[model samples]
Target chain A: MAAVPELLLDPAIKIWVLLPISIVMVLVGILRNNVTTLFLSPKRTVPNVRLLKEQQHLGLLRTYRRNHHVFISQSDFDEKFDLFKKEYEFDNLMRHYVADPEKLQKLKENPNDFNTVMSDLSSGDMMMQMLKGNLANYIPQTVIMYWVNFFYKNYIVMKLPFNLTNNFKSMLQSSMNMIDLDASYVSAISWYFVNLMGLSSIYALVLNDNEMVTQITQQTTQQQQPAPPTAGGPTVDQLFNSELEGFKITDIKSCFTTIHDRVLEKYQ
Target chain B: MPIVNPSPRQPIVIIMSSNKKYLLNQYKTSQYLNLSPPNLLQLFNSCKVFLATTNKLSPLERQSILELYFYLSILTNHDIEAKSTLQKLKESLPLTSKSEKLAVLESYYLEAIGSTNTSSSTSQEKKDAKQVSSSKKQETILKELEEYLTQVQTLIVNDENKSRAMSLTSQQAGPLSRMTTNDLRTIVKRKVALHKSFSSIDTYVNQLIDFLQVNTMDPFTWNELGQTYHKLGELTKAHSCFMEIAVLQPLNYKNWLQLADLEVELFYSGDLVAFNVLNDSILHYLRAVELCEVLVDAWIGLVVALKLIPVSEMEKSGVNSKLKPLEDLKGKYDQLLKLAAKKVNKFVELGLVTDDKKLNSVKAVLDDTK
Candidate 1:
């Protein structure tokens, strides 16, 4: 009776306690392995993602170089990266579908079926790969490490996160009613900051309006000064007056007489 | 310091000094500080006093003082004062023998009058009255004569001085004397006519003819006589003057052109005898064209004269002889038309002739000629 009682001790309770404890232990072990794999494992590193992104940016620049007319600097490159990312994603997706024309034709016929198939295939492939590497034992640690790298690449020095947060808040407000779950808020935030800061900084560095105004004012003032006197020549005022007097009206009939009189008076 | 009695010269000097100080104060206030009407008038009065007291000064000094007075008067809006100051300055200055001074004076007077007319309240009626006054007209005539005479005197003096100074005295004097004499005669004649003293026009014309006889080979002198005769309304004499010029210098296109114009005027006025004159004018133009075939005016005149020729006479004149003049004229016209066509082509190439109507009109004209 005592043995029976021990065996039958609230089956539900036993199941809850023992099952949870075992799951936790397994989880702990998996986390430990994941940590090692993410941080120290040699095989997890991908060689081509950075190179791919760099090549994508260069391709975009080449496309615009002949026809853009505007000069693009390093800052402009940062601004255009998001657009490149979208184009790259679409191109990659197209290439993936092009590799399997049967799947693409199925997709063209029924998009839902194609999506379901792809989702299932990708999930199955991920699980298989994870199992092959025994990364199921390291999933938690892998996630943590992935996050750490993301932070280091995108949010170190706090600027990236701050801008990202603001952009998220703006998008949340602007697209509050939109039901798109796949839209990337982080990418939007990055593009917003790049454009705003890049344009303002360039304008500040290139155009010095205050200095130009001062130069113009000084030049205008210099030109306004009166001309100087010359040697042996009558003063400007004297010459002006003498010219005036030479043409003045005197007695109508005796004008030359008056001129003669005036000339003689000065000589005398 | 006040206990000692001063001499009369001391009081006079003291008065003058005090007056100068007052004037200086007024000038400073008017020019720099305030510039009110009363202050300007005070400056003008002070300048006037300065001029009156400074009688023994040189013409240059007097000129400077008068200039100051004129400026002050203008600032004060005192036209009468400005005029008087200008008159005194002119009187005080020595006259140059050259016409340059007179010309400068005339221009200055005109500018001053224009400024006053614009700024002053003088009515249009008053200005018209002044312009129409016979005395004013005579005054203008006299001033012009004086200016012309001054030019003649300066030219003569300059020539004489040059002759005295140069080793090539005879050579220099001959052309210079001849030119100077011609200029003097023209100037005198113009001066007399400008004064409207037509009583001596015939005498002047006779004098011009005599002077032109000396240089019968000089086309310019003949042209001058022709112009003078034309001005005097002696068309026959003018035509003869140009004809003589055309005969002497057959290459002068203007002589032929003028002769043609005079003959055309006469022919248009119903003088059938003008046909011979027209023929003579065309012959001269043709001769001119022979000298310089590129003369465009000769070609144009020849075309115009051909239109005037009686059609009955066309056959009487030899076929080649009649066609030669027309062919030469047409050739020149074609050359001009080619230049015009080139310009029009450039415009067409530039897409400047956007209006279809204008483009069509130009094309039609070009096609008709073709």
Candidate 2:
């Protein structure tokens, strides 16, 4: 480890190589947000009324009520519970509204439907979404990788401030041929990847949770399958069932058992 | 802040993710201090360091604090500060990532406030609110409503809606129809806040009722409708809306408070003709306090409701007002006053830069009440 030699890097490398790559990544990210926002913010198109009617009740009230039950009263809870049980108990809703038995038959035949804008409702749109999302996510990344390799080649851009183990000697160097380069030193292409990862954090800081990246990933995965768990748009009956199921876990009654003590204890 | 959105009309509500305990406390405090903007500001500002600290405050909290600052500023007539604050919020906030409705509403209200003349005609539109139309017109209204709702659904959390309704000829924005559920509700609440005539609120109310007919489970929508009715002096209808909210959102003590407040308002409005309702209102306040003991409003509301029970009614119940019932009342009042005092003291302890005069008044109420 002590035998490893340090390659003195030119100050210009920091200015020309490191700085430009980071700036490019940041600029590209911002551009990506604008581009995606443009693509994402289209007016909603309802291709199939039947399909929409099915998807309307996914988690809207069920989720809201589960989280906010403490905000309502016992009578209110009972009233809602009764409505939930009457409509959504067991598989009553599933049979009546959610899972369309005829959906398979329609799919098997030449289903003439081609209007659902969201991929969930239309097979054609889902396929297109799959194609578009995968292309966008991967194409630029590969293109940039090859371009960085072609231009920067094998130049070591920066040295790590710390010493590295002999095991890291291979993986740390982006260039295999540069045997003289210590594990602490990074090649131009490898530096770009490292910088890309680092700049990704900056994007996280700027956009909260990198919601754009998450949305695309989610969209791509859910594109192929019609029913993604989160926003699957199950029928009203399904929503009722799920909400009823969720109510089992929400002990809303616990909020009022100690009314007298709770009211009196505050002053004491 | 100036991001191109599809629907500039929809108001966004972004509740921040913080310590759940703190967020709940904040929400309750916000409700308690609704009429007192200065105290609300002081309460929010008291946690300025904690709310702003990177680790202490989540991204949502950071965004929420700024939102509160914007709202509290606008409400208190700090127009210049609100303008600059709005700019700052736009430049460096979660306006990009969070619920955008409050900011949008704040800006919209500020503009609405700036020029009451244009919105004054809103009253005229509201008066025309109840002219029901032909069945064919109703069909078109329903069709347009469906389209608008679909568009709203697609417009992600931060995305805006692009409405074709705005460009529609007068014939299209039907007599009984206008705006999405959320937009109608926000405008209604705004009208109530401005103390405007109720004529304009009717159209929005009609639209909201129509929406509720379809989307019965939305508690906030019901609550908004209830508040609109409450403000419009339609206690019976407002009580129904609040009752719906209670049924839909049983865990929310707010619904109970609203119902209680409504009942009390009704009893008072009708010259205290309903002693049963007064008793019912007291029960609701008791429920509210049970759910959230820290809520000073519920405590105050309980005491006030009790005090409002006329001596004749108490005596009619066969309880001597001076000896037994009034004595019980005095004990409750003392406890409530203490709780309110404790709340104010807690705020001061937290270093809230509050209205000294208001705090003194609260104390004066505490001291002066023998």
Candidate 3:
């Protein structure tokens, strides 16, 4: 077992360094949120008619599959299922989209040009979206790091009033000129990170419940397809087919047991 | 120890702090509370003062303000300033705002306008032989609401149109991406609730049932869907809806009372599929009272259900175990009646229950002095 060292930090460090970094992070987050909202203007506000149609159909299918038994007779459910299967089975919109000669020609001529392909079925401006998300998350962090490194280098921001481990000492003393920096001490470079992580709740109150840290931390988890290389975006037909398969596998009867038994149970 | 001189609303501050626990109770008994108009006015003023003092009221708080104003105006008929409030809601609300209560209130205000206009037309028809044609005004308002609801339906219920609607709503002030499904479902429920015709309600039910298929956890929607059936005169489906609600929220006395009421309705209609429905109604009413003793509505429902239950069925259903509750109810019947009379007098003093039929109904039930 390794023994942990301790050092006490000055209360003055909280007011001077910690507060400034956190305030900066919170401000940066709000700025990024507003900027992101502004940048997506024309596309965000204008309805893409094709995408809307597909989504509405998907909603209809999902709603019907899950709850039709409650409202409709068994005969009606079966009839609707038959109609849905017939309409959506062979002429899958997504599959049809993949084979269009005009779309294929555009993709072939300029393989790297996402904007042209993304206009209709190819990913809904995914590259632009990814760029915006990454910029929002990483730009402030990298800029802040460089700014802090260049300005506050070789300066110890504060000393931790408690002792800590050698590993932590190395991390806290990254920019400090001292050879054996105290574990309890925080360099100005490292101080920025501690404050950045703690200012989420403060900004959430100010920015209409928008969290600054989430913009940075959860960027990698954004919707990106690692599926077939060419098909970059999720299409309505693909989702519909998958949802239909899910509906087929699970018996609705199992989810919905007769309510008569439920009602009778209380009586007994 | 005195940090600052307390405001005159000191008693209200204490009540506000104490009443947090009783909010659910208050929601259930808002009808009975509506009788005492002065108490309501006090509550409204206190809420208004608190809201004024608070920095940036949250959406939940705003929703409460809407509800309080709704009870004050709609229930108490003190809607003298309602038009200004309705205008305020319109001006402030983001065009694509997704609050369900907001959706309901929008329709309610419109409906109130329609009915009020109709009543005004007839009253003025006698005075004006040669002017003031306002009969078309009600039709126009109703038509506008119907058109708005259809647009919402296309935007939400139709999956193909949802993305388009999303893009359109993005331009609006407060329509967050998270509120898509919830907002749509709420719009559907509110629209159905406001539908004057049963056929319109039936059509809306198909969509509501489909939405509920996937999101069955929402109990309020389930109750709303059941009430739609109750309106459409489908007692079996109504019972099913309440039954589903009871299963989802076992401790909720409201669902049981609704179910008991449905059974009583069925007993009256002579549409008993099972001979045990009469006993079942009594059982459900008992269960409701047991779940919430403070539910004064449930007591009335119990009295109705019990009065209908045949004497022979009680014996067959093991009357011994249920005897104690019946005895307790009978013992307190006279006292409960007195409390009810006092409440009725308070309501009368407020001039709310002015209609003869309404007064006669209450007098028939609680007027045990004779």
Candidate 4:
């Protein structure tokens, strides 16, 4: 193995190259958060009432499945279960808007009809907001990377205080083409990358509950778009069927049947 | 300094007993507290004082204070203050926002106005010494509310249309300026509150059920439906509604107490599964007491429910396979009776139960169980 080439650059590189990139990145991140907040309106779009009802109904069924043994009697539980079953079969959930009975039946049969489901649940407002969020996320990083590359392309900005193995050479020393430079020495581009990722703590100190900042910043780290989680997932009918399956598997055990025993165990 | 003020240094003992707990505390509204006229006035004044420094508080704090002020003003029959508070809240909170709290407040405001209008007309009738135009005035009052109802209906229609247009055009969905399900429920609640006549309550029950069908998990609507059932003497329906609340919020001592009271009623009425429900009532009371150890009423209730369990059932060895045999279960009952007696005695000693007759009755019941 060859020894690393001893390279002592000017100390002024720390003041000129490193500080400017770090400070500019932090300021740009803060600015992007505020700009996104201004660009995206605060009002939440109301979902369709029938879809809302269906979602809430499914939630109630899930609660029942979890808590059948708590307080409800077997007869009452069965009655409610039978009622919900009948409603599910008839697709009474979307009765208000869905006029065609055949289409409703078809929907119940093939719940993965993505086109129909998407049309029913999608909101243009959400798509637009997501677009704006992506723009806010990518535009700044691109501009910052270009600015750093154009101005301080080949400068070795600073040496890390701690040593890193040669495995980090590709990451920490990206633009500077010196093969024997130790991996602990960070270049201008890698410094920008480090500042981009590591300045979250500094951003946290500067920002408050301004959620727009987090939403935009999170998109860069977490590649998953904050498209409404339910959208492009399982259709509502599919969710209903799955919840029904959960409800059906659980047997009703009323607390009344064993209350005396429980009380005795506690008191005695 | 040498004398040291030595006069037999006494030991300082701190009693450190728990404070008497209520299922519904002082923070609840006057309606729940059943506050008298003078106390209601005092509460209204204090709430007004809190409202004066709204700028200093956070947004959530300001909203809560404003809601408290609105409820107090309406209950205290201060029409001017109530109207102004409602107007102020409407300005601050978007009318189409999906918050049920605002919808409930608006319904209450409408009810208050309805009552005041009727009362004023009645007073005018008394001054004129005539009852001839009473029906006419009633008609006018109905017209006023109906006019407002039409306005709300039109708003709902407009919201529906806007949503349809958005769905078609894929346009930038405007702000959450849409009529919520709670808004519709609020209209029905206002109708129920104003027309306290027998027939409208039946319709209100149907409307509330319709609302609950959609928003199944809303505790507020469930509570409202339960109260309506209770008013109409449908104990079974009311029991189920209160049961939902108890299950939804198991930690809430008040819901447990309500359910237990209903169970006791159903047991006495012979409408429930007899022995099983009595045991359930005892369990509920035990839960209530567990939550608030100083709850004397729950102790009394526990005694009542425990006594109602037939001796024959307790003696049966094979009633439930999960339960212990006769001797052990019977001993458990005896232990529970002793526990209730001890708790009631402690409450009396702590000056919690001031009424002598009620105390004696509770003690007598506990002693009988023993």
On TM-score, the leading prediction is 4
lDDT string, candidate 2, B177-289, tens digits: 22233433333333333322223477667766655543556676688788788778889888878766665566587678778888898887884346556656766787776
Separately for all candidates shown, the number of backbone clashes (residues 3 or more apart, or on different chains) is 4, 21, 24, 0
- Residues B1-370 of candidate 3 have per-residue lDDT tens digits of 0012222212222243213224334444543242344555565565445445655656655545645555555544545445556655665667654334455565666565454344346656646623535545434565667666666555543442343233311322211222343345455555544443323566568866865654555676788789888988999888877866664566677787778878888988888733356556656665665565444455555555544555445446645322233344343333433443454455555554545665566566654433
True contacts kept of each: 0.00, 0.10, 0.00, 0.19
- CAPRI rating of model 4: incorrect
Residue B127 shift from truth in candidate 2, angstroms: 26
Q: Which candidate is the best by lDDT?
A: 4
TM-score of model 4 (CA atoms): 0.63
Q: Model 3: which docking level applies?
A: incorrect
List per-prediction Cα lDDT, in the order shown: 0.43, 0.52, 0.53, 0.65
- Please state the CAPRI-style docking class of candidate 2: incorrect
Residue-by-residue lDDT tens digits, candidate 2, A8-116: 7899988877777667766666665555566553333322222332343434446435544343345555565676566544344334322565653443243222112
Each model's chain A TM-score: 0.22, 0.54, 0.55, 0.67
Stretches of candidate 1 above 4 Å error?
A1-268, B1-139, B147-218, B231-233, B269-275, B291-297, B311-370
DockQ of each: 0.00, 0.06, 0.04, 0.12
Task: Identify the candidate with maximal DockQ.
Answer: 4
Choose 1 or 2, whichever is better by TM-score: 2
- The runs of at least 3 residues in candidate 2 whose Cα sits more than 4 Å from the true structure, single-residue gaps closed, are A1-120, A133-236, A241-268, B1-73, B76-81, B89-106, B109-199, B207-222, B232-236, B243-255, B264-280, B291-370
Worst 10 residues of 2 chain B by lDDT: B167-176
True contacts kept of 2: 0.10
First chain TM-score, candidate 3:
0.55
